[model samples]
Target: MDVSSIAVVGIVLLIFGYGLFKRTDVSDAFCEGAKDGVKTAFELLPTLCYLMLAISMLRASGALEALVRAVSPLTEKIGFPAEVLPLAILRPVSGSGALSLLEDILNRFGADSFVGRTASVLMASTETTFYTVAVYFGAVKAKKPRKALAASLAGDLSAFMLSALAVRLIFG
Candidate 1:
Protein backbone atom coordinates (compact mmCIF):
# COMPACT_ATOMS: atom_id res chain seq x y z
CA MET A 1 0.00 0.00 0.00
CA ASP A 2 0.93 3.61 -0.38
CA VAL A 3 2.58 5.62 2.40
CA SER A 4 -0.69 7.34 3.42
CA SER A 5 -2.50 4.03 3.62
CA ILE A 6 0.25 2.54 5.76
CA ALA A 7 0.25 5.59 7.97
CA VAL A 8 -3.49 5.29 8.61
CA VAL A 9 -3.07 1.63 9.53
CA GLY A 10 -0.17 2.46 11.78
CA ILE A 11 -2.22 5.11 13.59
CA VAL A 12 -5.11 2.77 14.17
CA LEU A 13 -2.81 0.06 15.48
CA LEU A 14 -1.09 2.52 17.78
CA ILE A 15 -4.45 3.64 19.20
CA PHE A 16 -5.53 0.07 19.79
CA GLY A 17 -2.22 -0.78 21.46
CA TYR A 18 -2.49 2.28 23.70
CA GLY A 19 -6.02 1.37 24.66
CA LEU A 20 -4.89 -2.14 25.62
CA PHE A 21 -2.01 -0.75 27.64
CA LYS A 22 -4.40 1.49 29.52
CA ARG A 23 -6.80 -1.39 30.17
CA THR A 24 -9.61 0.72 28.67
CA ASP A 25 -12.64 -0.57 26.86
CA VAL A 26 -11.86 1.16 23.59
CA SER A 27 -14.82 -0.40 21.78
CA ASP A 28 -17.27 0.79 24.39
CA ALA A 29 -15.71 4.25 24.37
CA PHE A 30 -15.98 4.33 20.60
CA CYS A 31 -19.58 3.18 20.72
CA GLU A 32 -20.46 5.87 23.25
CA GLY A 33 -18.79 8.54 21.11
CA ALA A 34 -20.67 7.35 18.05
CA LYS A 35 -23.94 7.42 19.96
CA ASP A 36 -23.28 11.01 21.09
CA GLY A 37 -22.41 11.97 17.51
CA VAL A 38 -25.69 10.53 16.27
CA LYS A 39 -27.58 12.41 18.95
CA THR A 40 -25.93 15.70 17.98
CA ALA A 41 -26.61 15.08 14.32
CA PHE A 42 -30.25 14.38 15.09
CA GLU A 43 -30.46 17.58 17.11
CA LEU A 44 -29.04 19.65 14.26
CA LEU A 45 -31.01 17.96 11.49
CA PRO A 46 -34.09 20.13 11.57
CA THR A 47 -32.17 23.41 11.61
CA LEU A 48 -29.92 22.39 8.73
CA CYS A 49 -32.85 21.14 6.69
CA TYR A 50 -34.73 24.38 7.22
CA LEU A 51 -31.70 26.46 6.22
CA MET A 52 -31.08 24.38 3.09
CA LEU A 53 -34.72 24.62 2.01
CA ALA A 54 -34.70 28.37 2.47
CA ILE A 55 -31.57 28.67 0.39
CA SER A 56 -33.03 26.53 -2.36
CA MET A 57 -36.18 28.60 -2.47
CA LEU A 58 -34.18 31.83 -2.71
CA ARG A 59 -32.16 30.47 -5.61
CA ALA A 60 -35.29 29.24 -7.43
CA SER A 61 -36.90 32.67 -7.06
CA GLY A 62 -34.18 34.33 -9.19
CA ALA A 63 -33.12 36.58 -6.35
CA LEU A 64 -29.58 35.26 -6.63
CA GLU A 65 -29.33 36.29 -10.27
CA ALA A 66 -30.79 39.73 -9.60
CA LEU A 67 -28.39 40.28 -6.73
CA VAL A 68 -25.48 39.24 -8.92
CA ARG A 69 -26.50 41.72 -11.59
CA ALA A 70 -26.78 44.50 -9.03
CA VAL A 71 -23.35 43.75 -7.60
CA SER A 72 -21.50 42.89 -10.82
CA PRO A 73 -20.56 46.40 -11.85
CA LEU A 74 -18.85 47.26 -8.58
CA THR A 75 -17.07 43.90 -8.40
CA GLU A 76 -15.89 44.19 -11.99
CA LYS A 77 -14.44 47.62 -11.33
CA ILE A 78 -12.53 46.18 -8.37
CA GLY A 79 -10.93 43.56 -10.68
CA PHE A 80 -12.90 40.65 -9.24
CA PRO A 81 -14.17 38.34 -11.97
CA ALA A 82 -17.91 38.82 -12.13
CA GLU A 83 -18.30 35.33 -13.53
CA VAL A 84 -17.72 33.79 -10.10
CA LEU A 85 -19.94 36.20 -8.21
CA PRO A 86 -22.77 33.73 -8.07
CA LEU A 87 -20.46 31.28 -6.34
CA ALA A 88 -19.42 33.98 -3.92
CA ILE A 89 -23.00 34.93 -3.18
CA LEU A 90 -24.22 31.38 -2.75
CA ARG A 91 -21.13 30.11 -0.93
CA PRO A 92 -22.00 31.98 2.23
CA VAL A 93 -25.51 30.58 2.08
CA SER A 94 -25.25 27.05 0.70
CA GLY A 95 -22.20 24.91 -0.04
CA SER A 96 -24.01 22.67 -2.55
CA GLY A 97 -25.35 25.65 -4.45
CA ALA A 98 -21.95 27.30 -4.45
CA LEU A 99 -20.32 24.06 -5.64
CA SER A 100 -22.82 23.86 -8.53
CA LEU A 101 -21.99 27.44 -9.47
CA LEU A 102 -18.28 26.67 -9.19
CA GLU A 103 -18.66 23.73 -11.60
CA ASP A 104 -20.43 26.01 -14.06
CA ILE A 105 -17.70 28.64 -13.73
CA LEU A 106 -14.98 26.06 -14.28
CA ASN A 107 -16.85 24.62 -17.27
CA ARG A 108 -17.64 27.99 -18.85
CA PHE A 109 -14.14 29.31 -18.29
CA GLY A 110 -11.68 26.45 -18.57
CA ALA A 111 -10.29 25.37 -15.22
CA ASP A 112 -6.85 26.82 -15.88
CA SER A 113 -8.15 30.22 -17.00
CA PHE A 114 -8.10 33.37 -14.84
CA VAL A 115 -11.77 33.29 -13.86
CA GLY A 116 -11.66 29.61 -13.05
CA ARG A 117 -8.53 29.98 -10.96
CA THR A 118 -10.10 32.90 -9.11
CA ALA A 119 -13.18 30.84 -8.41
CA SER A 120 -11.03 27.96 -7.28
CA VAL A 121 -9.22 30.16 -4.83
CA LEU A 122 -12.43 31.77 -3.62
CA MET A 123 -14.02 28.37 -3.11
CA ALA A 124 -11.01 27.22 -1.13
CA SER A 125 -10.79 30.35 0.96
CA THR A 126 -14.39 31.01 1.92
CA GLU A 127 -16.62 29.05 4.32
CA THR A 128 -20.26 28.01 4.19
CA THR A 129 -20.87 30.88 6.57
CA PHE A 130 -24.59 30.62 7.15
CA TYR A 131 -24.52 26.86 7.46
CA THR A 132 -21.72 26.96 10.01
CA VAL A 133 -23.50 29.60 12.01
CA ALA A 134 -26.69 27.63 11.89
CA VAL A 135 -25.01 24.43 13.04
CA TYR A 136 -22.64 25.74 15.70
CA PHE A 137 -24.85 28.45 17.10
CA GLY A 138 -27.87 26.25 16.94
CA ALA A 139 -25.96 23.44 18.62
CA VAL A 140 -25.16 25.73 21.51
CA LYS A 141 -28.76 26.92 21.61
CA ALA A 142 -27.70 30.52 21.15
CA LYS A 143 -30.82 32.64 20.95
CA LYS A 144 -29.27 35.51 18.99
CA PRO A 145 -26.87 35.07 16.06
CA ARG A 146 -26.67 38.61 14.72
CA LYS A 147 -23.11 39.20 15.87
CA ALA A 148 -21.82 35.84 14.69
CA LEU A 149 -23.50 36.21 11.30
CA ALA A 150 -22.06 39.69 10.77
CA ALA A 151 -18.54 38.55 11.66
CA SER A 152 -18.73 35.50 9.43
CA LEU A 153 -20.02 37.53 6.50
CA ALA A 154 -17.23 40.06 6.96
CA GLY A 155 -14.69 37.24 6.86
CA ASP A 156 -16.31 35.86 3.70
CA LEU A 157 -16.20 39.25 1.95
CA SER A 158 -12.52 39.56 2.72
CA ALA A 159 -11.82 36.08 1.42
CA PHE A 160 -13.81 36.75 -1.76
CA MET A 161 -11.85 39.91 -2.60
CA LEU A 162 -8.52 38.37 -1.68
CA SER A 163 -9.09 35.19 -3.68
CA ALA A 164 -9.22 37.14 -6.95
CA LEU A 165 -6.27 39.27 -5.93
CA ALA A 166 -4.26 36.21 -4.94
CA VAL A 167 -4.90 34.44 -8.24
CA ARG A 168 -3.96 37.51 -10.26
CA LEU A 169 -0.77 38.06 -8.32
CA ILE A 170 0.21 34.37 -8.43
CA PHE A 171 -0.81 33.43 -11.97
CA GLY A 172 -0.29 36.66 -13.87
Candidate 2:
Protein backbone atom coordinates (compact mmCIF):
# COMPACT_ATOMS: atom_id res chain seq x y z
CA MET A 1 0.00 0.00 0.00
CA ASP A 2 0.96 3.65 -0.25
CA VAL A 3 2.71 5.56 2.53
CA SER A 4 -0.50 7.40 3.39
CA SER A 5 -2.40 4.17 3.89
CA ILE A 6 0.38 2.72 6.02
CA ALA A 7 0.51 5.90 8.06
CA VAL A 8 -3.23 5.81 8.67
CA VAL A 9 -2.99 2.16 9.75
CA GLY A 10 -0.12 3.06 12.06
CA ILE A 11 -2.13 5.83 13.68
CA VAL A 12 -5.12 3.57 14.18
CA LEU A 13 -2.93 0.86 15.68
CA LEU A 14 -1.30 3.33 17.98
CA ILE A 15 -4.66 4.54 19.28
CA PHE A 16 -5.94 1.04 19.99
CA GLY A 17 -2.61 -0.07 21.41
CA TYR A 18 -2.59 2.84 23.80
CA GLY A 19 -6.16 2.09 24.83
CA LEU A 20 -5.26 -1.55 25.45
CA PHE A 21 -2.18 -0.61 27.45
CA LYS A 22 -4.28 1.73 29.58
CA ARG A 23 -6.88 -1.02 30.17
CA THR A 24 -9.53 1.04 28.35
CA ASP A 25 -12.34 -0.40 26.23
CA VAL A 26 -11.50 0.85 22.74
CA SER A 27 -14.73 -0.38 21.16
CA ASP A 28 -16.79 1.40 23.82
CA ALA A 29 -14.77 4.57 23.27
CA PHE A 30 -15.31 4.31 19.53
CA CYS A 31 -19.04 3.87 20.09
CA GLU A 32 -19.08 6.95 22.35
CA GLY A 33 -17.24 9.00 19.69
CA ALA A 34 -19.67 7.81 16.97
CA LYS A 35 -22.66 8.75 19.15
CA ASP A 36 -21.23 12.22 19.81
CA GLY A 37 -20.61 12.72 16.07
CA VAL A 38 -24.26 11.89 15.37
CA LYS A 39 -25.37 14.25 18.14
CA THR A 40 -23.29 17.08 16.72
CA ALA A 41 -24.71 16.42 13.23
CA PHE A 42 -28.28 16.69 14.53
CA GLU A 43 -27.43 19.83 16.49
CA LEU A 44 -26.06 21.56 13.40
CA LEU A 45 -28.75 20.38 10.97
CA PRO A 46 -31.15 23.30 11.44
CA THR A 47 -28.44 25.92 10.97
CA LEU A 48 -27.23 24.15 7.83
CA CYS A 49 -30.75 24.02 6.43
CA TYR A 50 -31.27 27.72 7.06
CA LEU A 51 -27.96 28.61 5.45
CA MET A 52 -28.67 26.51 2.37
CA LEU A 53 -32.09 28.11 1.94
CA ALA A 54 -30.67 31.62 2.18
CA ILE A 55 -27.92 30.82 -0.34
CA SER A 56 -30.45 29.34 -2.77
CA MET A 57 -32.72 32.38 -2.55
CA LEU A 58 -29.84 34.79 -3.03
CA ARG A 59 -28.70 33.00 -6.21
CA ALA A 60 -32.17 32.40 -7.61
CA SER A 61 -33.23 36.04 -7.15
CA GLY A 62 -30.38 37.36 -9.37
CA ALA A 63 -29.22 39.55 -6.47
CA LEU A 64 -25.73 38.09 -6.65
CA GLU A 65 -25.18 39.14 -10.27
CA ALA A 66 -26.59 42.58 -9.55
CA LEU A 67 -24.22 43.04 -6.66
CA VAL A 68 -21.29 41.93 -8.79
CA ARG A 69 -22.20 44.37 -11.56
CA ALA A 70 -22.82 47.16 -9.06
CA VAL A 71 -19.39 46.76 -7.55
CA SER A 72 -17.48 46.05 -10.75
CA PRO A 73 -16.27 49.60 -11.45
CA LEU A 74 -14.86 50.17 -7.97
CA THR A 75 -13.29 46.70 -7.77
CA GLU A 76 -11.66 47.04 -11.19
CA LYS A 77 -9.87 50.18 -10.01
CA ILE A 78 -8.60 48.32 -6.95
CA GLY A 79 -6.92 45.59 -9.12
CA PHE A 80 -9.58 42.96 -8.41
CA PRO A 81 -11.14 41.15 -11.35
CA ALA A 82 -14.86 41.72 -11.93
CA GLU A 83 -15.31 38.06 -12.77
CA VAL A 84 -14.01 37.10 -9.32
CA LEU A 85 -16.29 39.50 -7.45
CA PRO A 86 -19.07 36.95 -7.51
CA LEU A 87 -16.79 34.41 -5.90
CA ALA A 88 -15.71 36.99 -3.34
CA ILE A 89 -19.28 37.86 -2.39
CA LEU A 90 -20.32 34.22 -2.23
CA ARG A 91 -17.16 32.88 -0.56
CA PRO A 92 -18.07 34.01 2.92
CA VAL A 93 -21.58 32.61 2.70
CA SER A 94 -21.01 29.19 1.11
CA GLY A 95 -18.05 27.01 0.33
CA SER A 96 -19.82 25.08 -2.41
CA GLY A 97 -21.05 28.25 -4.00
CA ALA A 98 -17.59 29.81 -3.93
CA LEU A 99 -16.17 26.60 -5.41
CA SER A 100 -18.63 26.60 -8.28
CA LEU A 101 -17.84 30.23 -8.97
CA LEU A 102 -14.13 29.46 -8.83
CA GLU A 103 -14.55 26.58 -11.28
CA ASP A 104 -16.39 28.87 -13.67
CA ILE A 105 -13.75 31.58 -13.33
CA LEU A 106 -10.97 29.09 -13.97
CA ASN A 107 -12.73 27.52 -16.92
CA ARG A 108 -13.70 30.81 -18.50
CA PHE A 109 -10.45 32.72 -17.89
CA GLY A 110 -8.01 29.81 -18.24
CA ALA A 111 -5.94 28.81 -15.19
CA ASP A 112 -2.79 30.50 -16.50
CA SER A 113 -4.54 33.86 -16.74
CA PHE A 114 -4.55 36.55 -14.07
CA VAL A 115 -8.20 36.10 -13.16
CA GLY A 116 -7.83 32.38 -12.62
CA ARG A 117 -4.70 32.76 -10.51
CA THR A 118 -6.28 35.48 -8.38
CA ALA A 119 -9.41 33.39 -7.90
CA SER A 120 -7.26 30.39 -6.99
CA VAL A 121 -5.35 32.37 -4.37
CA LEU A 122 -8.48 33.98 -2.98
CA MET A 123 -10.25 30.63 -2.70
CA ALA A 124 -7.33 29.05 -0.85
CA SER A 125 -6.87 31.98 1.53
CA THR A 126 -10.43 32.72 2.59
CA GLU A 127 -12.90 30.88 4.79
CA THR A 128 -16.63 30.23 4.45
CA THR A 129 -17.45 32.77 7.14
CA PHE A 130 -21.21 32.48 7.63
CA TYR A 131 -21.17 28.73 7.30
CA THR A 132 -18.37 28.52 9.85
CA VAL A 133 -20.12 30.91 12.24
CA ALA A 134 -23.36 29.05 11.82
CA VAL A 135 -21.90 25.62 12.47
CA TYR A 136 -19.74 26.69 15.42
CA PHE A 137 -22.16 29.12 17.05
CA GLY A 138 -25.12 26.92 16.28
CA ALA A 139 -23.33 23.93 17.80
CA VAL A 140 -22.68 25.94 20.97
CA LYS A 141 -26.06 27.70 20.81
CA ALA A 142 -24.49 31.17 20.90
CA LYS A 143 -26.99 33.79 19.74
CA LYS A 144 -24.61 36.75 19.42
CA PRO A 145 -21.58 36.40 17.16
CA ARG A 146 -21.34 39.98 15.93
CA LYS A 147 -17.68 40.51 16.80
CA ALA A 148 -16.66 37.13 15.42
CA LEU A 149 -18.64 37.74 12.25
CA ALA A 150 -17.08 41.17 11.75
CA ALA A 151 -13.56 39.88 12.19
CA SER A 152 -14.10 36.99 9.83
CA LEU A 153 -15.55 39.29 7.17
CA ALA A 154 -12.61 41.61 7.52
CA GLY A 155 -10.24 38.72 6.92
CA ASP A 156 -12.17 37.69 3.83
CA LEU A 157 -12.12 41.28 2.57
CA SER A 158 -8.39 41.46 2.99
CA ALA A 159 -7.95 38.22 1.11
CA PHE A 160 -10.26 39.37 -1.68
CA MET A 161 -8.61 42.75 -1.97
CA LEU A 162 -5.05 41.42 -2.05
CA SER A 163 -5.44 38.24 -4.10
CA ALA A 164 -4.87 39.92 -7.44
CA LEU A 165 -1.82 41.82 -6.22
CA ALA A 166 -0.41 38.62 -4.77
CA VAL A 167 -0.86 36.74 -8.04
CA ARG A 168 0.80 39.59 -9.94
CA LEU A 169 3.76 39.58 -7.59
CA ILE A 170 4.09 35.81 -7.60
CA PHE A 171 3.45 35.12 -11.26
CA GLY A 172 4.60 38.29 -12.96
Candidate 3:
Protein backbone atom coordinates (compact mmCIF):
# COMPACT_ATOMS: atom_id res chain seq x y z
CA MET A 1 0.00 0.00 0.00
CA ASP A 2 2.62 2.48 1.06
CA VAL A 3 5.95 3.11 -0.69
CA SER A 4 7.89 1.49 2.13
CA SER A 5 5.55 -1.49 2.14
CA ILE A 6 5.99 -1.95 -1.59
CA ALA A 7 9.76 -1.67 -1.21
CA VAL A 8 9.75 -4.44 1.37
CA VAL A 9 7.69 -6.70 -0.91
CA GLY A 10 10.03 -5.97 -3.78
CA ILE A 11 13.05 -6.86 -1.66
CA VAL A 12 11.51 -10.16 -0.57
CA LEU A 13 10.63 -11.06 -4.18
CA LEU A 14 14.14 -10.23 -5.30
CA ILE A 15 15.61 -12.44 -2.60
CA PHE A 16 13.30 -15.29 -3.51
CA GLY A 17 14.16 -14.97 -7.18
CA TYR A 18 17.87 -14.87 -6.47
CA GLY A 19 17.61 -17.98 -4.33
CA LEU A 20 15.91 -19.79 -7.20
CA PHE A 21 18.53 -18.84 -9.83
CA LYS A 22 21.88 -18.08 -8.21
CA ARG A 23 24.72 -20.31 -7.00
CA THR A 24 23.47 -20.08 -3.46
CA ASP A 25 25.91 -20.62 -0.60
CA VAL A 26 23.18 -20.08 1.94
CA SER A 27 23.89 -23.17 4.03
CA ASP A 28 27.59 -22.52 4.33
CA ALA A 29 27.08 -18.83 5.02
CA PHE A 30 24.38 -19.51 7.59
CA CYS A 31 26.54 -22.06 9.35
CA GLU A 32 29.47 -19.67 9.41
CA GLY A 33 27.33 -16.94 10.92
CA ALA A 34 26.04 -19.34 13.55
CA LYS A 35 29.57 -20.40 14.38
CA ASP A 36 30.63 -16.77 14.80
CA GLY A 37 27.65 -16.10 17.05
CA VAL A 38 28.52 -19.09 19.23
CA LYS A 39 32.10 -17.93 19.51
CA THR A 40 31.06 -14.44 20.48
CA ALA A 41 28.70 -15.79 23.11
CA PHE A 42 31.43 -17.92 24.66
CA GLU A 43 33.84 -14.97 24.73
CA LEU A 44 31.32 -12.69 26.37
CA LEU A 45 30.07 -15.08 29.05
CA PRO A 46 32.65 -14.10 31.67
CA THR A 47 32.06 -10.42 31.09
CA LEU A 48 28.35 -11.00 31.40
CA CYS A 49 28.79 -12.88 34.68
CA TYR A 50 30.87 -10.08 36.17
CA LEU A 51 28.35 -7.45 35.14
CA MET A 52 25.45 -9.43 36.59
CA LEU A 53 27.32 -10.02 39.83
CA ALA A 54 28.15 -6.32 40.17
CA ILE A 55 24.56 -5.30 39.46
CA SER A 56 23.34 -7.84 42.00
CA MET A 57 25.73 -6.38 44.54
CA LEU A 58 24.43 -2.89 43.80
CA ARG A 59 20.87 -4.11 44.34
CA ALA A 60 21.86 -5.80 47.61
CA SER A 61 23.65 -2.68 48.87
CA GLY A 62 20.31 -0.76 48.78
CA ALA A 63 22.07 1.90 46.75
CA LEU A 64 19.97 1.07 43.71
CA GLU A 65 16.79 1.53 45.73
CA ALA A 66 18.01 4.82 47.04
CA LEU A 67 19.08 5.85 43.54
CA VAL A 68 15.64 4.96 42.18
CA ARG A 69 13.93 7.02 44.89
CA ALA A 70 16.23 9.93 44.23
CA VAL A 71 15.34 10.02 40.52
CA SER A 72 11.66 9.20 41.01
CA PRO A 73 10.60 12.84 41.44
CA LEU A 74 12.41 13.99 38.27
CA THR A 75 11.04 11.12 36.17
CA GLU A 76 7.58 11.75 37.58
CA LYS A 77 7.84 15.34 36.42
CA ILE A 78 8.84 14.15 32.93
CA GLY A 79 5.81 11.80 32.64
CA PHE A 80 7.45 8.36 33.11
CA PRO A 81 5.02 5.81 34.55
CA ALA A 82 5.75 5.33 38.25
CA GLU A 83 5.63 1.56 37.72
CA VAL A 84 8.57 1.69 35.25
CA LEU A 85 10.87 3.77 37.46
CA PRO A 86 12.96 0.82 38.66
CA LEU A 87 13.48 -0.65 35.19
CA ALA A 88 14.30 2.81 33.83
CA ILE A 89 17.00 3.31 36.44
CA LEU A 90 18.51 -0.18 35.95
CA ARG A 91 18.50 -0.05 32.13
CA PRO A 92 21.57 2.12 31.70
CA VAL A 93 23.97 -0.13 33.60
CA SER A 94 22.91 -3.75 33.08
CA GLY A 95 20.56 -5.43 30.66
CA SER A 96 19.99 -8.61 32.69
CA GLY A 97 19.14 -6.63 35.80
CA ALA A 98 16.78 -4.43 33.86
CA LEU A 99 15.13 -7.41 32.13
CA SER A 100 14.58 -9.13 35.47
CA LEU A 101 12.72 -6.06 36.68
CA LEU A 102 10.88 -5.70 33.38
CA GLU A 103 9.86 -9.36 33.42
CA ASP A 104 8.48 -9.11 36.95
CA ILE A 105 6.47 -6.04 35.95
CA LEU A 106 5.18 -7.73 32.82
CA ASN A 107 4.23 -10.86 34.74
CA ARG A 108 2.40 -8.91 37.47
CA PHE A 109 0.77 -6.56 34.97
CA GLY A 110 -0.43 -7.88 31.62
CA ALA A 111 1.46 -6.88 28.46
CA ASP A 112 -1.46 -4.74 27.33
CA SER A 113 -1.26 -2.79 30.57
CA PHE A 114 0.55 0.57 30.64
CA VAL A 115 3.62 -0.60 32.52
CA GLY A 116 4.14 -3.72 30.41
CA ARG A 117 3.55 -1.91 27.12
CA THR A 118 5.98 0.81 28.15
CA ALA A 119 8.59 -1.81 29.06
CA SER A 120 8.08 -3.58 25.73
CA VAL A 121 8.62 -0.42 23.71
CA LEU A 122 11.54 0.71 25.82
CA MET A 123 13.27 -2.69 25.59
CA ALA A 124 12.83 -2.84 21.82
CA SER A 125 14.39 0.53 21.07
CA THR A 126 17.03 0.94 23.76
CA GLU A 127 20.51 -0.57 23.87
CA THR A 128 21.74 -2.96 26.56
CA THR A 129 23.87 -0.02 27.69
CA PHE A 130 27.43 -0.37 29.04
CA TYR A 131 27.80 -4.04 28.13
CA THR A 132 26.94 -3.60 24.46
CA VAL A 133 29.01 -0.44 24.11
CA ALA A 134 32.03 -1.97 25.77
CA VAL A 135 31.93 -5.29 23.93
CA TYR A 136 31.20 -3.87 20.49
CA PHE A 137 33.91 -1.23 20.66
CA GLY A 138 36.34 -3.53 22.36
CA ALA A 139 35.81 -6.24 19.77
CA VAL A 140 36.60 -3.74 17.06
CA LYS A 141 39.47 -2.29 19.15
CA ALA A 142 38.12 1.20 18.71
CA LYS A 143 40.02 3.81 20.68
CA LYS A 144 37.66 6.75 20.57
CA PRO A 145 33.99 6.47 19.73
CA ARG A 146 32.91 9.80 21.13
CA LYS A 147 30.59 10.68 18.24
CA ALA A 148 29.22 7.16 17.77
CA LEU A 149 28.58 6.62 21.48
CA ALA A 150 26.81 9.98 21.68
CA ALA A 151 24.49 9.06 18.82
CA SER A 152 23.68 5.62 20.24
CA LEU A 153 23.10 6.94 23.77
CA ALA A 154 21.00 9.80 22.41
CA GLY A 155 18.76 7.25 20.67
CA ASP A 156 18.37 5.38 23.98
CA LEU A 157 17.27 8.58 25.72
CA SER A 158 14.79 9.32 22.93
CA ALA A 159 13.36 5.78 23.22
CA PHE A 160 12.85 6.25 26.95
CA MET A 161 11.05 9.57 26.42
CA LEU A 162 8.92 8.34 23.52
CA SER A 163 8.00 5.04 25.24
CA ALA A 164 6.87 6.95 28.33
CA LEU A 165 4.76 9.29 26.20
CA ALA A 166 3.34 6.36 24.18
CA VAL A 167 2.33 4.47 27.32
CA ARG A 168 0.55 7.52 28.77
CA LEU A 169 -1.19 8.29 25.48
CA ILE A 170 -2.26 4.71 24.74
CA PHE A 171 -3.11 3.56 28.24
CA GLY A 172 -3.15 6.50 30.62
132 Cα displacement, candidate 1 (Å): 0.8
- Residue-level lDDT of model 1, residues 1-172, one tens digit each, is 6775999999989998999999999999989988999998687667666655765676679886688788889888999977788788778977766766676678768999999999999998888998888888777755689999999899999998899899888778
Error of 2 at 139 (Å): 2.3
Q: TM-score per candidate, in order?
A: 0.61, 0.61, 0.58
Please provide, for model 2 over 1-172, each residue's C-alpha lDDT reduced to its tens digit, 9 standing for 90 to 100: 6775999999999999999999998999999999999998787667666665765677679886688788889988998988788788778977766766676678878988998999999999998899898778887856899999999998988898899998888778
Instruction: Tell me the lDDT of candidate 2.
Output: 0.84
List candidate 2 stretches off by more than 4 Å.
Answer: 1-70
lDDT of candidate 1 at residue 62, scale 0 to 100: 82
Whole-model Cα lDDT of every candidate shown, in order:
0.83, 0.84, 0.75
Error of 2 at 16 (Å): 22
Candidate 1 TM-score to native: 0.61
The root-mean-square deviation over C-alpha atoms between each candidate and the true structure, in angstroms, is 6.8, 7.2, 5.5
Best to worst by lDDT, what's the order?
A: 2, 1, 3
Name the top lDDT candidate.
Answer: 2
Superposed by TM-score, candidate 3 places the C-alpha of residue 16 at a distance from the truth, in angstroms, of 12
Per-residue lDDT tens digits for candidate 3, residues 76-171, read: 888886667777666876776676667666877887887789988888677677667777788785667777778877888888889979868766
- RMSD to native, candidate 2: 7.2
List clash counts for every candidate, in order.
Answer: 0, 0, 0
Clashing pairs in 2: none
